[model samples]
Target: MTELRDAALASKAWPFEEARRVLKRYAKAAPEKGYVLFETGYGPSGLPHIGTFGEVARTTMVRRAFELISDIPTKLICFSDDMDGLRKVPGNVPNQEQMKEDLNLPLTKVRDPFGTHDSFGAHNNARLNAFLDSYGFEYEFASATEYYKSGKFDEALLKALHEFDKIMEIMLPTLGKERQETYSPFLPVSPKTGHVLQVPTLERNLEKGTIVYEEPDGERVEVPVTGGNVKLQWKPDWGMRWAALGVDYEMFGKDLIPSAELSSKICRVLGTQPPELFNYELFLDEEGQKISKSKGNGLSMEEWLTYAAPESLSYFMYQKPKTAKRLYFDVIPKAVDEYHQQLRAYPGQDLKAQLNNPVFHIHGGDVPASDMVVPFSMLLNLASASSAEDKATMWGFIGKYAPDATPETHPGMDAAARYAVRYFNDFVKPEKVYRAPDVQELAALEDLVAALKSPEAALEQIAKKNAVMGNDEPLPEADYGDEDFLQSIVFAVGKNHGFEPLRDWFKAIYEVCLGASQGPRFGGFIALYGVDETIALIEKALAGELG
Candidate 1:
């Protein structure tokens, strides 16, 4: 494990140089065993987006990295600012028009449209929890409502007032020239009149650091800090929390630059230690547009998990922490296969060693020399053989490929293997299988099928024909270049036919080509899967009963 750590230190993946510098500075200033906290302000105004996961996932990696280096305990604090007033209605909510009147109140005061929870904030919190739980992250959620109600944040609030002048000095420069005076250092909600104290500046008592409030009659009243319950403005509040919580590190999205700037000022004012900050770029779709709930252009973690394993999803998150990158729909399957390959490569090493290896972190581990070694296509093709075959069947095939590959009866192995297979099925869509063709195309496919005797020979001929004709070449009038055409050819020749839907047939073809059903072009797939087996399987499917 120490060797692994040494390797990680030497490797580029760990970013050890930057981390060392940051850690040294942190240790010098703070010294105390502060909780390493990752803070994200959840509005509960919309469905949690991929960006939410992006923040949490990256923070988790950093926390893990810290744990790897030192014994300092870490806490990933997911803060839901449900006490925040609703600014606008979320698109998914019903009767959004009614929310306008409810805007000024806390999110906890808003009605839940789904009728499943006590309030809108509660509903959103649960949804976010379900999403996070799927990733197996160990996290502690702190609700703004709960924190305020429990008075856990009171100490920081008091510190903000004491250091108010210093905090103002840090914050005022960031605001625009026109709005600088209007921006107060705090969000003060008066308990008496429910009126917010929207003061412009520290108007009086500069020497004593006391805030002076002017009465309607023009008399100045100095408010003394009797206890640690002063409402520090947003910027000061952030800094105060850092000192109060003793957060060693936290990451935020690039979009939160404004809030981060303000928080920095507050930290200076409160004279508290500020956490190390890592800002990550947002996840974009294939088109290079940022994934946003407002735009409705991104896939949620739930949707991604439907086709990919949690580990694969985590791998995608880990690949690059701060790069502005696009996540194509196809990346998941490759990730799944790569994850399994990594697991196999580090067969006997302890878990810690496997995690710290950069090669294992990215491309994946080498296949274990003693493990069952079947081409991915074989397992996928076998899966296409029947809907019931699933991941269990795939495991059986791997075991059969290597007699030494026995069923992992242990709970851990079974769970891990199940995750790998599920990821493969959901994320990898085999492209080799075409859709059902019309009768005319089916007839042409049948004629083409007749030209082959051996599966290998037939696939070779097809490849040659494809090479000579080019991918754009027109097939006979009946050929639509879809799964039905391929199935008709398979039906014409007897092969490993399975009892499944037409969709499964296409999936089987993909399995035969790529270890997963979704991937590169079919011509390339044939090149990869080998021509002989490709044609033989087609012949087998064509000759056998539809089952």
Candidate 2:
């Protein structure tokens, strides 16, 4: 534990770095509330997306890092602003026409389109909980409607009432001239109509903790700001929530940096410091446009899971988070392979190096060993070469390469095999463009086939030369399954045929034999797929039967 603490203090991993900043906040003393609070806020206006998963996942990474460094307890809250008025119906959901009538009402008041939960907010909230729960994130769910109506936020609401002018002063300059005139921190939910009204505050009565505003019908109504009758405008509400919950750390998208800054000032006005903020760059679609829940242009969370493991998604989220990344199907295979690479490297790494390893932060220090005997790329190629329709088909080759591995013993590999088959069929198969090998490529491939066919005969000749030279090693006795020896033969065949920049040779093999332009190490593929099968595959390519 002491060694881990020492390493964590100096670890350069972003989560540990962010956690250290959080640790500084409590350098003098722990909070009076006993535990440091971490929060990730959700709008609950739409279904939870990849971005929502990212915020919580990244925050959880930091929280886990903080746990390593500090003895003080910590809590994470997944807060949902479900009390905000439903401004418009989301295009993704069903029964949009029905939801149109519920506009201007709190999301908790809008009718559920799916007819499952009590309201739209509740339905989305349930989905959010299920999403987080599936990932096994440790968090407490907080609802704005529940907090406001249950009087949990009464004190904070009253404080905002007393500090209304101060909050207004901070908010006014940021708005346009027209909006500034009518802007008030409090949005009162009409008692008669259930609409959250955004109107100018005609009067403030701090003694009674009430605000007076004129409704659209020209009737003036005074309502207590403490109850569910009113909710603060988003910016002020953000600050008030931070103050009310005593959040120690919260991270938002880089797009919200200005809102974060404004909310910080408002938090100070409410007599509490804002949580430590980390602004991450937003994800972009394949076309480089910023991804949005409404636009629906990027990869969905379910889509990612369909073609890869959840950990791969986490791995994607964990990498260089401050830099904007393209979230698309093309990125999935690379993420999956690299995540396993990190896992494979973790056990061999030292304590400090392990601390910096992604799997360390990803699994909260209990990193698992990668059971992937076959790289995901290899599996994908195997799927393509074998025309695999299911995981069981890929496993036929996988079983030969790794005899002991099974669905029960190596679940990660089993899952990867399944993902590989799905990914290959969906993405790889459609785009494959096999071409006939040019003259030099054809000669090199023919040489490879000859070598594969008579490897034992060539080994006998090598053995004779070793005996003639009185060499003790006896040429190290390799069989058809030896990837390095087979790889050397391929390399020699290419070089013998005068192929320059040798990648062209590999590319020729992939394009001619595999119907792809790139692939796993040929040697490794042969070792897994078998030498006889590879020779047969090469013969097919030579005879123009592959494409």
Clashes of 2: 0
Best by TM-score: 2
TM-score of each: 0.66, 0.96
Model 1: runs farther than 4 Å from truth? Answer: 1-11, 15-22, 26-30, 33-41, 116-118, 190-235, 348-533, 536-547
lDDT per residue, candidate 1, 1-547, as tens digits? Answer: 6875565455455534334445565554545655445565565767676667767766666555555555555567887777665667776778676765666556776778777888888999998888778766678887766776576776665566666667767877877997776666654333433233454544545345446554334555555322321245555656666776766566777887778767866776666657777777887887889887777676677676665446667667776667886766656556655655655667666555665543343323332232324333334444444322256755654443344554553333334445445544554333334334344434433544453334453454444555543654533333323334443344332222221443544444444323344433333333323334445655554544222
Which numbered prediction scores highest in lDDT against the true structure? 2
TM-score, cand. 1 vs. native: 0.66
**Deviation (Å) of 266 in candidate 2:** 0.1
